[model samples]
Target chain A: MPIGDAPPLVRPIVGRANRPAITSHRGRARWERLAPYLLIAPAVLVIVLFRLWPLLLGVNFSFTGDGDRNGTPVGLDNYTDLWNDPVFRIALRNVGLLVLLLPVAVAIPGLLATFIFLRVPGNRLYRTVYFFPAVLSPVIIGSIFNLLLAYDGPLNELLQTAGLGSVDWLGDPKVAIFTVVGVHIWATFGMALVVFLAGFATLDTTLLDAARSDGASLPQVIWHVIVPGLSRTIQFVFVTTMIGMLTSMFGLLYVMTSGGPGGSTYLPEYYIWIQQGQMNRPALASAASTVLFLVMLVVGLAQIGLLRKAGRED
Target chain B: MRELRVTKWVAAVPMMAIALATIYPLIFTLNVALKTRHEYILDRFSLTESLRWDNLGAAWTSGGISRYFINSLIVVGFAVALLLLFGSMAGFALSHLRFRGSRTLFLACLAALFIPFQVIMVPLARTMADTGLMDTYPGLILAYVAQFLPFTIYLMASYYNGIPAEIVDAARIDGNGPFGVYRRIMVPLGAPALLSVGILDALFCWNDVLIALLMMPSAQHRTLMIGVTSLRGQYSSDIPTFSAGVLIAAVPVLAVYLFFQRQIAEAVTAGSMKG
Candidate 1:
């Protein structure tokens, strides 16, 4: 038997064997009392200094101005500037577009996981292949897609060969955001797929078995049985997919669009980057950052509330 | 589930197509990377007549990817090391040791996890600048640790929670103190969790662009992802070399994915379930 499972009486014998290791009871006790704090200090220190403290500082910094009014508080002037900027407005509109597309983003992975769960042909291979891209950096994905989506790129070449007029994918403002979002989904749905598969692992297979025995159609089984059973995972996916779209598409936008063709592809994260890094407006960037945080906060909490209500109805 | 025999096969058709689409971009890049510029212009989609390695050589040698690759290596390597050490230490403490403010500390970590980098980048840049750590290797490393430490601690704590408390008790009764137990017992026992969390943290640090961009602003300090971004502008007319640079940047991650796919999946799902 393991020492962990041994009787209490045996601990005394073990203690006696190593008695020299703890020479002083008071010293040992003091060390024991301080050990946890010592261990946690580095992590706590880094987080508080770099992560938590910066959040408070960023919000405070947002109220100040840039350049001539650097340290002087402008009292929400930066926010009004953000509100007035057309590019920021486009960024906000693109955010709304992402929210609209969130369902399609979640559904692609959910349905794929369902099929994989149902033991479709090449399920294992599909799972492995699909998840591969999720591990890749968005910069790589965007670069590759940049080649494929170029006007004289292979995609356009294929379209022309098929006798269809080729579209200017990244060069057109109307199509640039959608193209980036589509590539974002393509790159990240695998992540949600893996998450969905994990949810499938937790699912009560008996429900699936019962549905099959009852001769339920595929769509019916998906709607009634699978959806209800995996509601939590669905909700998780929805919130995460939304968050991923909002925050993680920076590399793609930077590489593929650079918020280009009149800044049509500007997400808030990219907006924050450009203002701070390119435009040298740290205060304005902070305001955009604060607004982005609020947007995420509202969206995340609203998602949880809405999903809980929907789950309850189910 | 197997009862949908016809449906499964029919579904497989589209599934295979999707799989092809998923894998095709990388394959196309690889093919293009192996092609001469002349060959690429003539036929972008065709298989390379020869396994030409010149573009790869040129990219690795002259495209600045090599420097960025080393920069990423040093930064990610140190960041992952520190993350695992601090993460496991804090994990063991929070999960096993009775202490003041333990609960609050854990909650603080959890709260930090939700604050995305964009939300924190501005002040963080300022903080780094104020401390004279901006545009340096250590600044970026510290930034990555801050960005990922919470998730690391959470996962490590969750994993450590599963190990029987009786084991810790046994170690203590055997006259080993907290540090002794940690070094002799917890680290070894926590190796699996460390590996999973370490790989995940490494990937996050490695694939990161925005943080690296903000923290390391110099031309020579670019991480690989940042390097890949510049490859586009540098080689705008040279698609083969651009693809070659991208392939170079991807190879490390692709190798890691191929080897640790299961652990990566486990770490990812563990995160999702807990969150």
Candidate 2:
């Protein structure tokens, strides 16, 4: 039988229960059949109990009340509170900002990966230096930037020496989110660049050579040849980068801004942390978590759909 | 040809500039770490006249970083070990064994990869608390395992799939059972994948703040990353000491990144390319 057509749980149990007859060849054959399930049992158990089950439980919990009305079902109230809360609104808006900034984030790595793919001078050193920060914790990165972006810090000092005005990098509300996002891009673009380089590794160099032989300009070659060739990688980076923006910048916001400068740098993950951990509003945080989950789900589905359509065109 | 050459040089300029930008912060932090608080206040831009070993010494001995560093080490070590063992077991079984619901289980694992920890963290925390595992080392280790196991299994499965089944058949023909093949043959064959995945998982567990924060709530249980965060508030006015603390938290990661940089990139791209 094909893997997809495997029978349900009954056969596995039947095989296991026959172990008392182990002296028989039939029992030994049954053991052979049960080995794969036995091997996978622990991983399956952990993933189901912790990862998958909690997802369902969290969505169920989101509709309940927090605090004095704890564990009591209050349908849609938590979500309404989330929608009305201004901090959560800013978090949602910042998610939108991340969506808008996604292209720039992806493009930076894509372009650099292309250059490195072409083996630019000092490409190896550039890759090493760039990827170093990606391995560092965001807390360390944030703390380091905390010094560099301080009002009288080295960056501002350099700006002052350049005869330019020193801007408040983390203190100004309008600028704090962008500043954090910029640091995030700095820290993470190397990851995407590595992914892009991996994609470039699979590209047929003959296509690039063909385009070059046709005297195509750099931009034309990129647009007509590389873009089409690496569409999947581009889409992969887009989704993963957006997911990183949404879910992984918590440490940066936590240490660098603490969702401050008037609560301006709150992403969904940080908002969830604050509501659940600091604010003691787990239900409300669950609602926000649900929204974040939905956003990711929609993004994932749309990309898969787009990938399918793109594949069809091919 | 001339145009391409010109473009390459143009690209080289920014690439070099970016490389400087990338390396500058750590250099700046190192310089700051080497300064005394007095010197840092006097001239943050100036190079330290002497390496102030006292700052690093104070940070390590008294800043609670040593405790947090041990906590992270224990949790990440056990977590990566568990992930590799469980991941390789499932990968071997799934790739080579014929079993019921195997495809469904594999798909389920794949589906679980999409559920990032943030989505389930609230309930997962409650689950941890309910089981009396919260705020404990094993609790945190289990959490890390749950978080990274799917990715680990996926990569291991993909890697093992490349091994010809005839070798497995030969091993079986040599009177080895499934567990025997796994122990005597598969584990050896899966070493490279296990190394890549283990390094990535170690980095994830070590560098994580949010999961560590949620799972280990007490001050004594903080991971190194958490220790670094606490350093910010504790040493806010003491820039040199804070820089030293940051360096202490960062140095091991720096060491790991330097040593295993290739494996890390390989693991990261392994997931992407397979997808």
Instruction: Write down the C-alpha DockQ for each prediction.
Output: 0.56, 0.61
> Which portion of correct inter-chain contacts appears in model 2?
0.74
Please write out the lDDT profile of model 1 over residues A1-314, one tens digit for every residue: 12122222213322235466465544555666677789999999999999999999999999998999998999989999999999999999999999999999999999999999989989999999999899999999999999999998899999999999999999999999999999999999999999999999988988888988999989999999999988888888998898899999999998898999898999999999999999999999999999999999999999999999988887
Native contacts kept, each candidate? 0.73, 0.74
lDDT tens string, model 1, B135-224? 999999999999999999999999999999889988877767778888999999999889889999999899988999999889999999
- Which docking category, incorrect, acceptable, medium or high, applies to candidate 2? medium
Please name the candidate that would achieve the greatest DockQ relative to the true structure.
2
Here the TM-score of candidate 1's chain B is: 0.98
lDDT for B205 in candidate 2 is: 90
Model 2 chain B poorest ten-residue lDDT run: B168-177
lDDT for position A301 in model 1:
95
